[model samples]
Target: MNTDIEIVTGFLGSGKTSFINALVESTLVDNEKVLIIQCERGLREIQKTIIEDKRVKIKLYDAEKPLTEEYLKYALTLYRPHRVIIEHNGTRNLIETLNIFNSKALKKHCKITTIFYISEASVFNFYLDNMGGFLLPAVEYSNLILINNINEVGKEEIDKIHKKIDSINPYAIIIGVKKGESIKAMVQKEKILEEGFLKKLRIFFKNIVYR
Candidate 1:
């Protein structure tokens, strides 16, 4: 059976590790085997307790080394995991990593289910300016974009950021999250956002195409 791959990416200190840890703890039931390929070390480490689970395995790779198709293929063949999660480096080009996932050889073994981009709302604009075009690919390709540290910014500010993100990738499900928020709540929000967004987008496209 093909493994399901989830790519979690963001700028440095964007809470990708925290989000992943919360997600795994809450949703991964029934001893589901998970293989986590971490390309960068975050400010916070995933707790030792999470790793103690027999079903969860993690491999940390050097961020300087390119995450090539050959390496990914070898990892997949070796682990044969039920699901794969990549904690991608903030500085790496997301498109390049995604290309490896898109390769024919990798496709036969694993398929990418979702790409989640976690953005720290407070420093979003700074990164956008400093990183230049490096950040666009991840935002454009993400299935969901979570703007973390929402409590640090007001709703108006968050909305502005949301609009900016929407302009780039209207199809992505965007949500604002404060600390201590439940992942289940975020998942629920995604469902609602996706449904409403898709409905409107479909109507708008239909009108344009028909007109």
Candidate 2:
């Protein structure tokens, strides 16, 4: 069976870990095994239930120890997870991180199914202003763009975020998620990927240029 890979990207304190917790608890089906590879440490803690779940496994990699295709292949051979979620480093270049998938060994072992970009509403513009190079490309490539901490901001602010993201990636499914909101149900209800051949073709070329 082909392992399904999903990538989550966001700046520090953007609630990327929290979103993964929600997906594991609410979106994933019963009896499914998953491996979560965290590339960056975040402020939020993984829930205890998730830590204890036998079906879930977590791995951490950082500057001292980096991810490699050989290690990834070994992990797949050992745990043999049905799905893999990679929490990408927020400051790193997304295009470079994506090159990991181009490896022949990884290509045979897994396929990327979704790319999610999460941002805290209050800090979205602030980060964009300082780190637009990192943030903009992530927005353009994501299949789902989640604006978290929506409850903390007003409608005008929320609308501004929506408008800005839409301008960058009209095909992406953008949603505002309030604190403690059930993202699993909402995200599962949407059509996550571009449906038609023409749109997929556009995305293919966009990715080529992006790389």
Candidate 3:
């Protein structure tokens, strides 16, 4: 059986570790074995107790050294995990890391389940101004874009951030989350929006052609 891989990426201090911890705590109870590989060290560390399930393992690597196909293949061989979660580095190029996963050797053993991009609402503009080129690709490639620390920012600011992200990746599900909040409700809301948008689009074209 192939391992299911999830890539979680975000800029520095954007809450990627916190989100991953919450996800693992809420889910993955029944999986046979799971592995979390961290490519960067954050100011805060994920506690062992939070993810101390007998079936789970966590590994941290140096951020300076980029992830290579040979190292990834070796990790897969050693862990033989049922599920794999990658905590990607903020400064690293996500495209390079994605390429490693796309390599024939790793692709045969693991399949990408989803790529999630998390952002801090308050510093979003700064990131766009300074790191836009590096960050845009991650936003475009992600399946879901999460704006964290929403409680600290105002609605207008949030809207601006939302519009910017939408312009880059309209198909991705975008959600605003306060610290320690569950993602289930936000995910459901995204689904409703997607359905409504499609319904409205069809009606819009029908009216234009019929009239």
Candidate 4:
């Protein structure tokens, strides 16, 4: 089976590590062997439980070196993971990073399942104003856009962010995670709902065709 790749892009202190922790603790299956590759060390550390889990392996790389297909192939050979989660550096260009997965060498071994762009609600505008160059591409290509620390920001600001995201990537699933909420649980619920809706639509079409 080809290993699934999940990319989580966010700035430092934007809760990316915490979200990854939730994914490992609650979302992933018990039997799944996961390889987490961190582009750089963030302010928050990975949860201890994840570090102790034999099913999960962690690797850190220098953000300056940039991720390459050669490194991915090496990781695949070494860890033999069922799934790979890349905690991408927010400052890096996502398009360049995504291109590595499209290379012929790594294409057969792994495929990208989801690209999640995480942002801190309180500093959403600040980042947009200062780092639009780095942030825009990530938002445009991401499958899911998660806004953290929503409770700390006002509804007006959140609405503005939503409008901006919709303009950039209308198809993206945007979710606001409030304080004390589980990011993995929320995202999993959204995925389940989307799958359920698609299944119902397929049945409806089948009935129409048969009738």
Model 2 ranges with Cα > 4 A deviation: 63-66, 180-211
Clashing pairs in 1: none
Better candidate by TM-score, 1 or 4: 4
Residue pairs of candidate 3 with colliding backbone atoms: none
Q: 129 in model 1: Cα distance from truth in Å?
A: 3.9
- TM-score top scorer: 4
lDDT of 2: 0.79
Could you tell me how far off, in angstroms, the CA of residue 153 lies in candidate 1 after the best superposition? 2.0
**Which sequence of candidate numbers ranks them by TM-score, best first?**
4, 1, 3, 2
In model 2, state the lDDT of residue 99.
80
Model number with the top lDDT: 4
**Predicted candidate 1: what Cα RMSD to the true structure?**
9.2
lDDT of 1: 0.78
Cα error, candidate 1, residue 131 (Å):
3.0
Q: Which lDDT value does model 2 have at 137? A: 82
- lDDT of candidate 1 over 23-104, digit per residue (tens): 6665454535678988987787876877898878999998888788988888878876667889999889998898787778
- Shift of residue 175 alpha carbon in model 3, Å: 1.7
lDDT tens digits by residue: candidate 2, 1-211: 5677889998778888888887676544555678999998788877899889898899887734546777788888888877888888887878877787899989987888889999988988777778877678899889888888799988898887888888888998887777877766565556443335654454445345434
lDDT tens digits by residue: candidate 3, 1-211: 4777888999778878877776565555443466899997677777677566777888898888998888878888998776788999988989988888877888888888789888888988678878888888898899888888799989899888888888898998877888667654555445522224453454345335434
